[model samples]
Target chain A: MILGVDPGLTRCGVGVIEAGANRRLSFIHVDVVRSDPHMSQDLRLLAIYNGLAAKIEEFAPDTVSIERVFAQENRNTVLGTAQAAGMAMLAAAQRNIPVALHTPTESKMAITGNGKAGKIQMERMVARLLNLNTLPTPADAADALAIAICHALRPAGALEGGEREQHLTPAQRQWAQAAQRANHGRGVKRGM
Target chain B: MILGVDPGLTRCGVGVIEAGANRRLSFIHVDVVRSDPHMSQDLRLLAIYNGLAAKIEEFAPDTVSIERVFAQENRNTVLGTAQAAGMAMLAAAQRNIPVALHTPTESKMAITGNGKAGKIQMERMVARLLNLNTLPTPADAADALAIAICHALRPAGALEGGEREQHLTPAQRQWAQAAQRANHGRGVKRGM
Candidate 1:
């Protein structure tokens, strides 16, 4: 089982999935933990942290996947996102669960075969992939599901192994090259 | 007693102090909690969270003061700083300790009477204020002390009071006005 976290101050999206052989996947859970903006900052963070920690304890995911966030124009949103992301990472660390970070583009490419896929398209793809009758409410939850699928289907050694290259399908190789080109000279951070 | 933390990825500065009447203060401890950059991102965050939690338990500070950070040019640095700051706030929240945030300018102004004071000048002032025989090694430590003192000396109502306009010294009122002007139409987030 893998847990994917979409960290945010107002509503943090969380998704859990179980991956079987031959790329089979099943949904374990999907939900969002929200906090009121009027609450104190520390209290808000505490709520998110506690929510994630409790989920970790209840689900017992073998790995935690987080979506990487870039610095947006709005500093407030960035701060809250970073804080929520920190809590997700810390909760996994406290429980000794391995973590993997996937960029939004990577997750999009993995799900829809295009890095620049639109939000609605990605949501449809996620629902189709999971065989869900309805789309996940609140795009944040669907995004978390995409992140989990991205990590689950990553190249064998892309995460833990140190190597120049690894085996990849034709589509996967194309996306990898495209992502590299997109990131070239941009100085965009890959992950934490 | 209050604990101030200058949150960072590589070296997080921590300072403890006791505030007394008439603006008098005494230092209890000052140090840095460092994490190796080579470690995994989650592990590094874990190290910081554990260190601050241990300090809170050992020192029993009434409040935790953190230096507020703004988004900077380097997204990686900003993310790390925000993550560290998040951990500091979370540790305080777990213990039910009140958390305070002071901007760098506020700390510099409180310590040296100049918001734009140089690093060396601020260090000198911190040493003088603490009556230390030697400067705090690694300027981050001194920066933490400055943050603690800034919060300690702030008007009682500035942090917790509902009506901030009612209680303000001339200098403070000027600073507040200047800060508002600086942040006009920028949507810059003040610390929570």
Candidate 2:
């Protein structure tokens, strides 16, 4: 499954697309998960983290594709968006899932055939690609769908790297070592 | 040593404050780590994470206090900020050390006796609190100092409550336990 995530502070548009046998997309689903504004920023981020984790569990997508943040004028605004995007990445990472980050230009080009395509053009392209009558609602959902289609077009050669380095940190790797040191050393607490 | 992080997109400002006995604070280090603008958002966030961890190891902070994000515009911007925040949080959490999250209002109230305070007001208060002749360079560095001050103001009662809630996920307790299980399983597979 190649899942697309359009992450934002207010609402994260998620699209799941399963690239199946015979080169056919066997499944697709789209929805917008809204992040709470009334809560404190930390709580809102916690909501995003848990909400996305629950959604990921429900969808069980083996891979996730998230749009990359491009540019921002306000420093504060950029910080909040970065936090939300990080939470999405962490959610996928915690589940040991593969993630491919797509820049806005790349995602735009994948769906609209032009990097500078307008929002409506990308929406129409996504609708056409998914064989839907009407475009996905509220532009963000359509953009998420387009992002999904972008992942679907990933060349097999690119995927040859095949799901390593997505593991935990070097410290985590150390803890995975044999018990030789555990028993060899005097009883002592090891820092993570 | 207490490490305080004021996460931002272009510049992630950090301050290391040594809170010695008698409630005295000495500036250990102050720095702003910059991320490449052209790199993907994930890479920038990863840079922040790696840089923060290296800083912690270098400074050997006994405590960490990070300011909570409160910006409320541009959903994409918020997501990015949240990503940086999450990365910082994850780094601390992995260390099994308790981390304190302080909001802007609380930090302001602690330092300046006003919950609603501007950046200049904060910089001035920080200068007065630490009795510094000159203001901390760039508002971000001073904000980081304020976060450390916020942690220094932790009452005995506050410490108990805060210590108890280390990574406490009310509803997601089950999920974290499952994750621990998977981690242990991986450890076993790797012959730990």
Residue-pair clash count for candidate 1: 0
Model 2 stretches with alpha carbons more than 4 Å out: A21-23, A73-76, A155-192, B1-64, B67-82, B88-146, B150-192
Q: Give the alpha carbon lDDT tens digit for every residue of A73-172 in model 1.
A: 4776988898898899999999999988888878888777788999999898788778899987788898888888887766443434435244444545
Best by TM-score: 1
User: What is the lDDT of every predicted structure here?
Assistant: 0.82, 0.65
Worst 10 contiguous positions by lDDT, candidate 2 chain A: A171-180
- Residues B1-192, candidate 2: write the lDDT tens digits: 788888776677788887665445677677887778776555666677778778877876776788776556455555555566667666665564456777776677656656677888888767766778899987778888888876665433233454533433231233233334655677421100
Candidate 1 Cα outliers beyond 4 Å, as residue runs? A157-192, B157-191
* lDDT tens digits, residue span A1-192, model 2: 777888776787888777664335533788887766775455556666667778789888877788776445366455556566687777776676777776676666555556677888878767766778888887767667767766765433222443422342232123222222443575422210
Fnat of candidate 2, please? Answer: 0.27
